[model samples]
Target chain A: MASVETTRSGGDTGLPDLVLRGMTLGYLGWMVVLPIIALGFQSLVAGPQAFLDAVLDPQAVHALKLTVVTALVMVVINVVMGTATAWVLVRYEFPGKKVMNALIDLPFAVPTVVTGLMLVLLYGPSSVLGTILGTYGFSVIYSQPGIVLALLFVSYPFVIRSVQPVLLELDRAEEEAAATMGASGWLTFWRVTLPTLAPAIFTGAALSFGRALGEFGSVILVAGNQPMKTKTTPLYVFGEIESGNKQGAMAVSLVLLALSLGVLISLNLYQRRWSLEDGK
Target chain B: MKTRVQGLAFFFLALGVGLVAGCGGSSGPDASGDVIKLGAYSVVREAFHDALIPAFQEHWKQKTGRVVRFEESYNASGAQARAIASGFDADVAILSHTGDMNQLVEAKRVSPDWAKNPTGGIVTHSVVVIGHREGNPKAIADWSDLAKPGVGVLYPDPKTSGGARWNINAIYGSAYLASKAAGGGTPDLAAVADLLKRVQANVVNMDASGRQSMSSFSERGIGDAVVTYENEILLRKREGKPIEYVVPEATLLIESPAAVVDSSVEKHKNREVATEFLAFLTSVEGQKILASYGFRPVDQTSPLLPEFPKPAKLFTMADLGGWDEVQTAVYGPKGLWTSIFSDQGK
Candidate 1:
């Protein structure tokens, strides 16, 4: 035990360093590295041609385009609404403020399927509003609009939660000092407040975008799942599985996996740069 | 503590591996030595879970000191097929459609001849039609009437629901009534196909399951008329809804076939008993039980009918050239159904 400790601590000659290195490598290999390797191997056997076929299918292509587009659009909408929501909650004093603040997170508590089913119940063609929407030729369910609505419901909390802390940390005295300098309300916010909030808002939006991309339970119920017109990538994968297509499910998962990883890595790099800048 | 952790880990690992190996032999807890496991659709499962399972257990115990059991997952055919394809363990699967069984055949879990047996055994079957809130206010008498202005129709997706296909076939038959050149008395397949195009337009919701669709339609007032099995209509009507059913002219017939799994058929060591179970399902007694359960019997022309009987040669799966042909003609890309309803009934 003493000898092993001595070698491990490099107290004596370091001849067994190779063994230590191999052991360290093995731990990571089994835990972190091997599962990724297995995923790649499974994808290879699940028919590379079929994967390509599924991704390239006209229906899937449209769904992918719609998913990415809706997710991005949702992230943009939520960032503004969510940050404002957080700003109001953290920076205000009013009656019923706590209730209003908690309501922002109502979306998070609702089961996604319930969210979707509720939306249809409220706005489907059969509902009163649905009939009005139908009368106006502006349907929400069974259309692209419903996809965005579901995405927004699930993605709203990411921004509100992320922005709230950063907003609370914001020195309000700076705004007061800027007001003393005769700076306008808009100018005080733009110059003093916006930069600090950007990082947090972006982080929230990144998470929201990813959540929207992978969401399944809610969107299918409301989207009407009309093949090419309203089908999302997740629905397409589900349909393929039902059609006895395994390779297609893998391919769809690969696309989702690749996009999520890319966004997360880019986000990490982004936050790293911002932190470095703040340090300097 | 470290040793204990290792011991727990080893035990769980062995357990997991054992469970995976036991996957194919999966039978319900009620299985006695002489009985076989049968996976069933909703009605059969409802019976097994609520009534038949206990009865079968008691019957076998009293007669031969054995028990019959079932492992059930009851819902839409498409979901069931996907579950089976993803390695849901079952000795025998009785789904709402042959399409699901075909999935098992492709997986090499069941054989091609799984449907052939003494019963030609349709465990349960039903007539389907438009169900409305009392008074039939829209006066919907036939399938064509479903397209009337402001007629909000609710039906399950044909891709998923076995009963939904009969609705599809009924719609096809009605379309031919207006245009025989397309497919009608002269058996014009093209005319029938063309007629299906128009009916596809008025559909509001393409629900993935039958039970939920019916429940929502009745319980939540989701639609004006519901497309579903007569059994479901009967079940729903019993739930105190103001509902009435209208069977369209010359509506399509729905048939459900069931047989013991290939391995069970051969390996049960008592083929007589196995065959007897399936045989009992088709006898006059069995047929009567099915009728009482809201199913249409095999004999179409019989008196005291609960619903329409199975149609003749004109009403056959062979006439449509099997499931694959149906998929190609109606469900595939460039499919007539898609081309017609592309804009959702525009």
Candidate 2:
């Protein structure tokens, strides 16, 4: 029995496991790490002036501003929708609950390009709904609203998945006790419920915002890639590269990387803080 | 009982390892130096599949006696430039224009001057006014006909697509020519500027696919006209869409350049074979093949194939400041075209 157990140890399979880990690390290094390092080094060679010029360029600045603004709106929408989704899934029992439960995972299964295409089909100028919307001059495909929709499509899953576990783990007895005390549902939700979910919601929104900010493929397809308006930072990075301005491209890339890092760090800190409070 | 379970576990572990090893076998091509990677923009990719690949492979095989293979990545010019700049390797990069090649130069990945590099003589393609609908309902005759009130336009985003830049330049060049034919005696590029702004007002939205722009125009009622490569119009017409071509009295040319990647060839030390592939592109047989694929050949007296349509007003890079200037000026933000037309999106 001891020999059998010992054979299962990582040490016993050291060569293959080490090779597997090395392969994973190498794959990640080529795909992610090496390019980031090269890009960072390239940006550094351009120095501060190029960075400032890229960041302060009116068009890059506008695109970056729009990316942040849309991401914030998406974060708000996702937090509300995702929290409600988690709460309902945790607390409610209804017909088709199992099917409805399966649907939350659908966004994960669906490619974002499909999501953008679906939005275009449903709300674009050609669709039945789109034509009606078009008559009112409410074009959705190539406007600020389209960016919002695309961001929402990509980032929606993050918040729901993030909050569901915390909501499920939450004690029902506390809510019942509040109901017994004659507290109103809204009051109970506000005083007893919100505080517990706030940290999770925050973490999810940060993830959503980070994902939303960096989205390229789907957003560009729908957003018309309008300079100074629909052009997100990734799209801006694309334009800079096309224009033969590698320094400009690298410089803007670093800004996006820095912003993403900031969100990830804050989310990490919030998770740690919330876990400690939960422990106490 | 424990020994039986352990034996079963070990069997499963070996099975898993075997599966991974089998998958790992064919996952990547030979990492040995024998294989050559060629990265290109889209049409060359199609041409390689259709025309160049077999010839190049045969030619390389006859010479080296070792099997030579090419790895290719193809995309729109801007997107591909990003991949190359970020380190996708290519022994050669055959692209639509010199703007993207200049990007590699600007990044110091290539020799400072790509124009001076060994490659030759006019590779031909054409663009024309891809009109509103069958029988030309809008009757868009000249370049200025796009300005007819209530006539919207659909085209690829210029910032993101090389073909769209050619499309933009076509209209702009014609407008400039009209300014000259009026005999004030010079092409006023600014007229191209004004024309673009007015046309910009009518653009419902810019899309990335030239075909998608046409499809959107037809399906979504997105626009009245799309300016795209004439080959695109022919390609689409074959699919049985109701479409017509408007050969504007004035037109700009599309020349697809083929070049060996200086650094990539040096690294691979396959300059002889790489140069042969380019030679194949400029060869009479290659030009003949290009013509078959609907490229209007630059060799005028070489006899016309009956199927291909002749361009009305054929022009080339020599007419527009060439690729270096186009990269610095038009595709560059400070360039007249970008400074003017790009503002509409904002």
How well is each residue in B1-346 modelled by candidate 1, as lDDT tens digits? 9999999999999999999879846643333466554556664544446544455556556767665554456655666655655666544566766666676778766667776664354566666667987788888887767777777787766655666666676676445444554433466656566556545555666666677677767766766788887767765444455468776655555667665555545654545455555654565655665665566676655565445533332344445566666666666655655455443421
Q: What's the true lDDT of residue B136 in model 2? A: 73
Clashing pairs in 1: B182-B191, B182-B192, B183-B188, B183-B191
The alpha-carbon deviation from the true structure for residue A206 of candidate 2, after best TM-score superposition, in angstroms, is 1.7
DockQ category of candidate 1: acceptable
**In model 1 chain B, which range of ten residues has the least summed lDDT?**
B309-318
Q: What shift in Å separates residue B273 of candidate 1 from its native position after superposition?
A: 5.4
Cα-based lDDT for every prediction = 0.70, 0.74
How does chain B score by TM in each prediction?
A: 0.75, 0.80
Error of 1 at A70 (Å): 2.9
Per-residue lDDT tens digits for candidate 2, residues A1-280, read 0012334555655777889878999999999889889878889886788778777777788888989998998888999999999889888999988998888778767787888778777888768887898799898887888889888888777788878887888887998899999999999999998898888788788888988888987887778776655778988888676655777788889989989989988777777777677783
Native contacts retained by model 2, as a fraction?
Answer: 0.53
Docking band of candidate 2: acceptable
Model 1: TM-score, first chain: 0.85
Interface RMSD of each: 4.1, 3.5
